[model samples]
Target: MDGEPVDARWGSARVRGRRLRTVRAHAFAAAGLLLAGCASMPDSGEIRAVQASQGVDSQVRVFGVPPADKATPAEIVDGFLEAMTSDDPQLETARKYLTPAAAKSWKPSSAVTVLSSGLSRVAVRGEKDPEGPRWKVTGKKLATVDEHSAYQPQTGAREYEEQLQLVQDEDKQWRISTPPSGLVLSESDFQRIYMPVNKYYFAGGTLVADPVYVRQRTDPDSRMDPTTQTVQSLLAGPSRWLAPVVESSFPTGTELRTGTKSLSYDGQNTLRVPLNDKVGNIAQPQCKKMATQLLYTVKDLTGSRLDQVELLRSSDDKTSSLCSVTSVSADAIANRPKIPEFQYFVDNEKRLVRMKLDVSSEDQQTRTEPVPGPLATVPVFKVSSAAVSHDERRAAVVSEDGHGLYVVSLVGGGPMPAQVPIGRGGKAETLTAPSWDASGDLWVADRDPQHPGLWRVPGGTGTPERVQVAGLDNRRIVSLKASADGARIALLLEQDANSRILYIGRVERPDAKGDVSAVSVRELRPAAPQMADVTAMSWAPRGRLLVVGREKGGVQQARYMLADGSMVAASLPGATGLSEVAVAAAEDESKPKPVVAYSEDGIVWLPPGAQWRTVAAGGRSPVYPG
Candidate 1:
């Protein structure tokens, strides 16, 4: 059964009111399974499609078949490999192909190796084994999801090889004696089995999103639905890459009520979560924060809109409600940055200009006006790149020669303040660009080779301090952008003249009583490992980045990627020849701000569901308030 031809092809079935276009092939391997476990398949036949009705929801569902009696060693190996990709709740069907002792010891959740294609199995020609047989499984690895569900993309296709040993049971039945340490799945199978969800944690006074992959349906090992699994992950604490910069509201030993396998929202769209005794004494203020985290973490799951989250204390007799928070109340506790009021850019006159966000292309000939106050009326230096404060009251601009940095108030007319002391007037690479965080601190990178480092302006007013960035060995920071939450920062590092990579780093500050001067950036993680070169990137809504770059040997294009570096979340529609891009931070996700880009044709805007249209004829840099 190593290379036997398959008998089944793509077919259709009705499951609950939706139609399923069943996938019966895995890459070049013949890995087909039936919806019902006991259904019999053809022994030998050609693969062909089975026609079915259209106009129904097209969802894919794959199931596994149990091993047959008196199966051969090769057949058992093939059956087990295919079963690993099935919809087994606990992977129990796949374990049937293993020896009783081996099944008891194997742990599938340890790690996940994602391959570009299905595994190819071949018998070992000369290996002598005490067991019945030996087989080699090999494939090209694309990525790996760690035990923490953090996804890391491999720079290139890496070879994956493992050996499987088989033995004969007491009844003379073939079974796998030694199995792989963890799961090995194809790319398509991994996407179908798991989905990315953002688990919220506290970074200072604001909530930060940490992306992790969880099973879409009931987890095979935990037997918990997606909602319950997400809550447990949140209680487990932040991922290792993000742990140093964020904190969780839940108590250290907190967990769900004993034997809580599933959670659901009531008819009023309120979810009641029962916690263990560890949280029974939690204060009202702290309990509200815990519920706020749960409300945001599980909001992406498939269900009705969640209006509120109620926490209850588990007891021997009856649980008592600890605290509750509605959507409106939770937003107040989250403390997100204020939404931007207008989009800003440097126009043809080399002066900063503003345009109302409410004006769309449909409106005839939208007018552009210079920003209020001294930066526009009084001449200082030609504006090149700029960053607006979260409150939309102050603007940070870099001179055209990239030598000077200035912070000008958008309101109250006055002379532009003197150039920031950190900027050294000499060459174009002296300063990259400026970015603001939620704490009102300004961040910029000085690319001067002799003294290159990241600089932070305290509250956009106080003395400039050089920030210590760990893990930045000999890499020059060309550009930088800070997330609105102030916990994460994205940097474009120049490894060489040809290679530029994008990385997301955590911003860490000293404890309350510790030295306040010890603030630093830590643990820079790759945000776009698959892209060979990254030219530009901006922080988008919900802790994602809109990156403009290209893969190795490919043309440049714009795509949106999760900050966790898992996978490309989306591609920018109709985006081309982009040199710079900016996205407004909106509080209401349902109505997103238009995406602005600086292209060869000048500044262009992409309204939701529409083509990119020219906004400013000679605009060079476009930015929205951070």
Candidate 2:
């Protein structure tokens, strides 16, 4: 349904009243059945009658239809609004209360305003102009579902007021003529009619997907298909807020081969996708990426009904030239470069050590002694945090005093030179841990409240340049991590009252120069909004995030969250007192990888089995090469 603001006080009483009635009804039904002597021997006709009664009762729970032709203007408006909550395909019943012209033009799915229960009320002003009448709707707006169906939570008590205009038809029936383009539904109806799904996009040069909620027809035979809608929405590109940071492999102007036709499946449970000619020019690598995006998106929407996707130039094409794609883990996509197999962490002596994974062993344990880094031999300032470059040949270190950032090569046996300085020179109040993007550039936030800014330095010897980021005014960046693909950057922002918030932004770089010029930050919903502080975050496989934080009055904890802010229940429960977290994406998409976290006790690791194991007695700042 389309937009209207929600009222916090709306529908609550109604819901409670409904629940009471349901409990009473069930109690009475049970009692009646127990008292009936033939309850155990009820005839087929009797059972059918009881079932029919239940069906009617369920329909009544959703509210009955509004008055028809003889209904007043207020009645018609109320009925139309109520009808918006129905599961009728195309909202055909909701249209009955509108003029034919208005019915044909109204677009209910454009947006949705979710309101609190028991607080919505309509006020009707008499027919001032005789030719038309107007009504006002007031409520608290909890969140808004935009055209792309992304649910954005409102920051405060958002009260909304809408003016609706109505006209009379030739049959003398009152009807709404100028209804709002979007729909307004109670939170309950929204949950029943809408679902959240992720659309794949490339982040940090890797194929990752972000979740966006979309409305789906609840009817069993509606022409509107959720799978087709999802595919079309993905082709439409990422939501406006995320567009700047994520890239879509789909070519411009690409669309389903048959427009609105529902996806078809073969006997083998393979989805057949037909694409327009826009994809004809895409190179094989890009085509595969596109296929991967579609596969994940469609699989999510269809409950994994199809195991593979076959792309055709057009629906009519029967030739073998069409591309076929099988279901594979997101990690298997060829676009993302391979990460180094070794894990790195800082030891008690402030020295970097590497633990190599035994790929050939069934246990996948690190049996060899931890190798000290080449930089350990060189005299350097006390290190607080470090980031390994994407190529695994270099590392960036932040001084313990948060005054300087330095880069050191990790390869070669010769004594290493002093750490190379990068970024603005003067001492700052706080310097976040450094991060390396795909281009080998180093990024770190200078947390000087008076002049807080983000900076990018070239992989080699260029000076660090300040990068302007929108929507970061008056806030200190606590920590920053750039996605391996270089498309998105995640920042831990410290706000007033020691509140630590997480934000994701798009990174814009100059075409010729490798330095970043701007970053665009967008509001993000975290999986754990109640967390009082966010200590660490890292990108994981399948577009998930490994977030470590603590709720107010709670112990430190870590959880996985999808890009759209939904919590993933994938277990990693036993580890505790985590100070830093790291994840390594596996080469095989289907294989689960362990997540390493540095806790107060030591270096604790959570493998795929959700059990924690100690890797070292005194380690901190664990990391996997980007």
Candidate 3:
């Protein structure tokens, strides 16, 4: 798989070549080529240049003209595995190879994009050999580190045999052939290597094909196939593929659990976990996993809900369990303790390593209550809606005061969040809705005399921009907040006295096009017919939004997850807190990213941690099905 293409590339250039079976075993050969366009060439001469010198050696050259030439195929194989399972995938490795064209065509999608999966070993079949002799190389899936998608699996691997078809075009430079025929491959076969979709990254024989993962006919947990091809993910586990740390912070007394698999890390990190009952000294209330969910986080890892931990009932299952987390997880350390979150840290050996604590009041409580003090008359700004940015670097808060939005910096080590003014700037307006873009840009709905429209503020500090509305005038609507990624905005559009329509719009661009015309509804939330009206509304991670109301459906707030009109929205798995939610959003976009909330407790609430994303993303979080 590695050299076959290179040989063909050289062949296309009309270069006669002999296949060498090895590369050096010492230099730690790292091979990665993120080329996007093999189809573009101005002339034959340009193609010929590649043929002149591009060919992999079969044996370890250890010292050659190029760097990868000196590394062994084994080293290359092990290295990728090491990176995926250990040091973590660094996007820059492939970022270095993004051709100008490739970068131009790049469209950010909800799914993680892998730049390239390469191989070593330079084997080639003779002119006449059965099955064209195997082309082998090590492979690993490279992905963007999204805390929300930490639960999503890296579906690629290394150190495997592949069926390759090296296309020798007229030019002599080997070019990867065009895409394969869909109908030619069986549905079952396609899912394994080709696919009804490309989730596995197997191109299927034109370039290369291999069994990346398989359903075992016998053991459910362990597969009798190549470990490299094992889909340890769909089964359940952190991206690290072992018992991973769920989060670096957690709500106090929250339980934590691991998956049912043997976990280890980096070839050296091991866990001495107990399969019989619980792990001793490794956690609070030692010897615990027999009953409670394990809540833990190491002191060195600053993980957010994107970081995670896995549980193993036994060391044999492909996957045991996974936990959600809420601290920036690189090293275990103290996290921003504004809201309640839970985290757990464990090793590949299924042993617990560290734990962190998060805190929040009960679901029924509101305002965290005034502690019987003389400051009771002062209005307590309770959290109405909340959203954590992609990196967990900051949290967006919407409260009941005129200070429309606030950014809770997870890194700055602050007690009280720094506030941003959103209202008329002079009066005490109830600042109650906030959201964020992936880059930590702040979007808040400021409600008061003059500042009654949706506003935008970047995290680094700058002027706020007004989100334009088409049909409705500025002062007519109370508040409007954008979706988590800032692709859409949810607004409480005014109709008359008793009713208001909540609209989410596809914002063209806040800086250039003040396009207020792109509004559509994932679902239209109704205001109460009795008592009063809709005060504030928010779109949670999924298509679910919490609206403060006074009517029947308003008082006893019912949470609804609206699928992007095109699909079906799932109601949150088990949401309890309901004092008053001004806003909410999907934790992330990968696995079942939860509906995070700024609870009635004046603090925010999130899923357990790490296992936040879900495959059922609405693409436009809570965006209308346009």
Candidate 4:
């Protein structure tokens, strides 16, 4: 009874005149009943059968295992590399191409080198031997995803090569006996199997998070639990690219408690994480901070399944609560200062004026008047760029002539002073815009190629001191912006070919008190490699960067990019021919932070809807208080 009418058309045809009309009506009613029956829900057995079919189809590996009996050494090596792309739970299918002992000892989590697509090659080294044969694989390396799944731009070696040793088992089957500890995959495969996860760290003594890519497995029985793996990676600390800048509260050697199986969610959707004895020594404040880190990391992995984090400390075969907290109270552990809602710029009159940001309104327009201050009375000439202090009471400005750097009080009482000289000749060859750090120190870079270097002044006063920047030799710094967190600095360097590159360097201060003698810059990492000329850049909320630049064959545009070199397309339709960009990094949760740029048309702003609204005509440099 598959809910279909039986011979209704025949009945209508056989009936005569008036009887025929009635017969057709009955046939129509029967057809409606048939459709109604078909619309009913399927039985439990039928539903289960459909779900089973879908599950099996999804479990099919991306790379299939090939018969090894007739495969060559080079073929085995290629197969093993291809198998790394599979999402097979424990990678058991990948293990089939490896010798039993090698498979057991191999650690794919050690590292991952993302190779350029269509550039990989495998070569057999020599003739086959009784044990097996050897092969060499090489490709162009794009980036390195470390053990913690943190990505770093490949700096030195452009080409990657590895030696693979294969052996034949008793059944005469080819298998990899001595493969590399880590795995290599194509760029497309890496994107398909991995996702970005941010790990929180403290910057300028305030809590902040940095993004890193982590592998996401589809198999329920995968060897590594994604939730637990994420927490462990966070404890491992920031990537090499960012470690020098950010600080992690977690002590060295922190790990999950022994005998703990996996991270689990309880009835209330709270995540219970039991850690080793190392956490027993952490103070109450630090314990809560650690809990905050765990909460964010786990929530990102499990989505809304986790509401809070309950940390348990294991000792004497017993577990006890270290701390428990939610995302709401996490701010109590952070010492971040409030950022101003107004945007400031030097007017055509050479006076400083601010425009208030009304994020609530549909237009999101700026206020009409500027705040009254000493800057209004002071005569600032040809201002190229200005950086507002963290307190919003002071500003540091650089002159267009590239000679003088001056600090001026924003509140109306301070005396108008002379320009701070940057070099020995009472003139700077070229001076970058000055930046104020949380500690009230001002930093600038001298673009003099003969003696190119970075300099720091105490609160934008006193004699400038040279800072040692590692790996900055032979490159000219065109622009510099110090991050509000005070842990890193963004630099625009000009290469020999006249191409501009964006780099982030970790700022290291001296340990000894009053030791302004020297500061070190280390672990420099590239942020935007595709841009041929970067006109301007600024830091955005959550450690992202707002960059304005032109690609090789593209028009100039502004876009957001993560610290790990991932691009986020923020549409600014009317913002073209942009010269500079700035962001408030507003802490307000109720409204979207405002971003402004100086386009050829005028000063344009991009608000919540990504629409470019004009702020002022003929405005040059736009900035927000740190």
What lDDT, from 0 to 1, does candidate 2 have?
0.63
Q: Assess candidate 2 and give its TM-score to the true structure.
A: 0.77
Local distance difference test values of all predictions, in order: 0.78, 0.63, 0.32, 0.66
In candidate 1, stretches whose alpha carbon ends up further than 4 angstroms from where it belongs are 1-58, 125-128, 154-157, 359-361, 364-367, 512-517, 580-590
In model 3, where is the ten-residue run with the lowest total lDDT? 202-211
Query: What lDDT tens digits, residue by residue, belong to model 4 across residues 68-92?
Result: 4667555565556656666655666
Instruction: Choose the strongest candidate by lDDT.
Output: 1
Per-residue error for 230 in candidate 1, Å, reads: 1.2
Q: Provide backbone clash counts, one per model.
A: 1, 22, 108, 0
Candidate 3, 1-626: lDDT as tens digits: 43354322112232211211222334434764332222211111112122212322212111111113223332222222122211111222221122333323432222222222332234455323543333343233332222222212222351233333333334332222221111111111112221110011101100000111222211121322212112232222222311121211122232223332432222222222223222212443222221121222121111222233333333343334322222233112211112323221111221111112222323322222221211122343344344455554555555444464656554543255456655655445456445555445666665565546666676626667665555444435556655443444566665666655555444444231243443222222222222244555555432234454444344434334231211112333323453332434433323332343334333233444532222211111121101
Question: What count of clashes does model 1 give?
Answer: 1
- Local accuracy of candidate 2 as per-residue lDDT tens digits, 1-626: 02333232333433222211222344567575322111111111222222211221222223224345477665566666666766666777677777788889988877888765323445455655654667777766667878776766665667877777877777777888777777887666666566678787876556655667665643322354778778878988887766665678888899876544577678997877778877776777777778778887877565546677777675345323356677754337735645566777777876667776543344433452433455666573357677887677887877666667777777765554455444344555367778886677788887765567888787644677777777776677787777766766788877666568776776665641244544433444443454677777887765566777777887767777665553342435763655544433332234455677777766666667546667777767777765
| Residue 524 displacement in candidate 4 (angstroms) | 2.0
Worst 10 residues of 1 by lDDT: 9-18
Q: Highest TM-score among the candidates is held by which one?
A: 1
Off by over 4 Å in 3: 1-388, 395-401, 404-408, 413-421, 425-428, 510-577, 580-585, 589-626
